[model samples]
Target: MEFKLNLTQEQKLIMTQQMQLSVKLLQMSNFEIQTYIEKELQENPVLDAEYKKNDNDKAQDEIDYKKLIKHLEFDNYGHSSYHRDDEEVSPFNFISAKKSLKEFLKEQIIDLNETDYIKSMCEYIVENINQRGYLGTSIEDIAEELTISQELSQRCLEIVQSLEPTGIGARDIKECLKIQLIEKDLKDENIFKIVDEYLELLAENKYNVIAKKLKITVQKAQEYGDIIKTLEPKPSRGFYTGEETKYIVPEAYIKKIDGEYHIIMNDGTIPKLNINGLYKKIINNEDDKQTVKFVKEKLNSAVFLIKSINQRENTIYNILEKILEIQKDYFEFGDEYLKPMTLKEIADNLEIHESTVSRAIREKYIHTDKGTIKIKDLFTTGISRVDSIEDVSTKIIKKEIQEVINNEDKKKPLSDQKICQLLKEKNIDISRRTIAKYREEMGIKSSSKRKRF
Candidate 1:
């Protein structure tokens, strides 16, 4: 065997430490960036943070204290006031902590007049109910684990199901809906039959099949489907999850001034950074070579950090400006008017790579008059219509599909094919399969399931 060595020249992209930091900072959310800044502040002695004064603080500072004091002294100093009997404290004001679904269920179990043994069993069952208000363990499993009979465990489950939310202990979605229906006194022999036997058909929007089986008119079947739609599938849906709610802090604000959208970067939360004067003096003194070298290195790091933060802000601002230009209709008219966009489009416009655009918008949010929205939500793939030269956004198509379904006749609910045809009339040339895909994505049932009577 022989080994040969040859000099090879090739160009490869290399990211420096500062470059990596800039990329990392660009992708971080406002909360994450704040935490990172706090950590960096602790570690970097040369780097200092300057916080901006809040608007409320400035307003309070501008208040006339002498006038306020005079008004308070004259109005209330010698006056006798009676408390209004009708003005009671809100119950919500007394609540210091939110109860999880499990805690709420356990509280109900405690109030039950059942024996301690049954209550313990009920408590155990409640503990196993997942965040979705469905039992995580089977009755047989619970019975074997707790050394209780299946009958007793089943009764405990029934008791738990009877608790508020109407379907806490249901094994599955069908049982959940059935329990809700029963509670509302809306359950009949046919409703129970449809829930048990024809749930799949109901989901497919096959009202005709259901009507034929139940020997009822299409309108009557539609009534049953409508009633089912009113039931809450997710009974535990508004209860607090164990995890804390994440509130999005917007990095930029888009405001319409004189019928034109303007992009403003929010630097309010970002700390103003500068190298400590003492550290700069230590570097310039040159009295201690070692000390000078250390201070210089730290100073360089601090400068790079400041530059990276600025670069992050600039990149985000440019990206949002381009988005504003492209999605002007969305900004003016709302989500329904959102046009299809892509990372590549923004990257092309800004003369940056697709990955750069993605990083710049990742985990970042923008606030507009419409409300706070994720930066990524502004970009969607397009579906072109046959009649129109311009493309339609998938989001817009989904919204249109929902509208078509919402306005549809219950007895003659539009199937995916019919939906595709209807969309075609509006210049949306999508396939039946694509229509079905979009329909399902919006959680709409099939023609079979949609049929009523």
Candidate 2:
């Protein structure tokens, strides 16, 4: 046995707390960054909040609460006949209103002429309805929980189902579609049968199978399917709350000028940070060691934070520029022209790790003529075609598949195999399974489900 001291020298990358914070800040959305800044402002004495000025020469933080109250009164009550005609109306009297699905249903329930017991039951059912406007609890469960008869529970369920949204209170998607179809009173018997028994087949686009079962022409089956397509699948889709709102603030902008594209970083919204001048003065003149040490530490943290923000902005800018270069055709044309790209490719080109590129683009968006698009959306897996050396983007392939399905003959909707053939003819070598996967992803039914009778 031998024990000897062996010394080895090796270089390894270790991320400091400041560096980790920089990566986290780079990945945060603009809204999230603003929130983080506010939190930092509250905790760090060396950081100060900067308020932007409007054309009215008022600091944004100095809002007029009295004016806001006046506007609200003008909008809600000023137009009444009892109000004085001489009162001046402000042009900014309008206020946005939002109503949740439950509130809307409760309002409708209030209008019903049923007994208080029945109304309460219906209200309970409404409360149990999910955000998708489907019943979250089973009639049996509701009946047991409320100590009511099953028959009463069923009646209450029916009452809730008859609400404004056609598909409201359905137990499942099949029930939802059936409710909408029954409400429309469209004279299509096979539609009901398909919804009840052959929904799986209908989803697969098996029009031929439906035709065989219903003893009708493929065209008629297609007509029935088309009618079903008009029904709303999500009864509560438009009634999403504030949490569901997708707030996208782009960090960069790409503009086309004189036949060349230019990349511009969006730093206007980001706060420009600097160490508090007063704190620096305190540190320089303070005689107490403890006070000086405290100020020095805060100043260093503030400085590091500012540096991290600048680095994040630069790194993101460079990443966007490279992406724009690679996906120039996509920007010039449309989604159909989007080329295949990966985080690794960008990382290799930028001489950074793939994770760095990923973190830089995560939850970040860029503005273009098309619209605001997520940076991550630009990168997709490539599908290699037959005759070309270059690989095609899966996004482009999905778009092409959707187009093929949209233009397809309803009586004879193309099968996944046929889709593969069509794409192969255009030099895309996608397999049938991949084609089916993409088709399903796009919410397209199979040929059998698509058949008409």
Best by lDDT: 1
Quick one: best TM-score, which candidate?
2
| Cα error, candidate 2, residue 436 (Å) | 4.9
- TM of each candidate vs. truth: 0.77, 0.78
Give each model's whole-structure lDDT: 0.85, 0.83
User: Candidate 2: which stretches are off by over 4 Å?
Assistant: 1-13, 54-93, 115-117, 140-153, 186-193, 207-226, 241-243, 257-260, 285-287, 380-399, 403-441, 445-453
Clashes of 2: 18
- lDDT for each residue of candidate 2 in 57-123, tens digit (9 for 90 to 100): 4432344556656546544554532222334334343344667888888899899988989999999
Instruction: Kindly give the number of clashing pairs for every candidate.
Output: 18, 18
By summed lDDT, the worst window of 10 consecutive residues in model 2 runs over 80-89
Query: Per-residue CA lDDT of candidate 1, range 218-238, in tens?
Result: 678767877887888888999
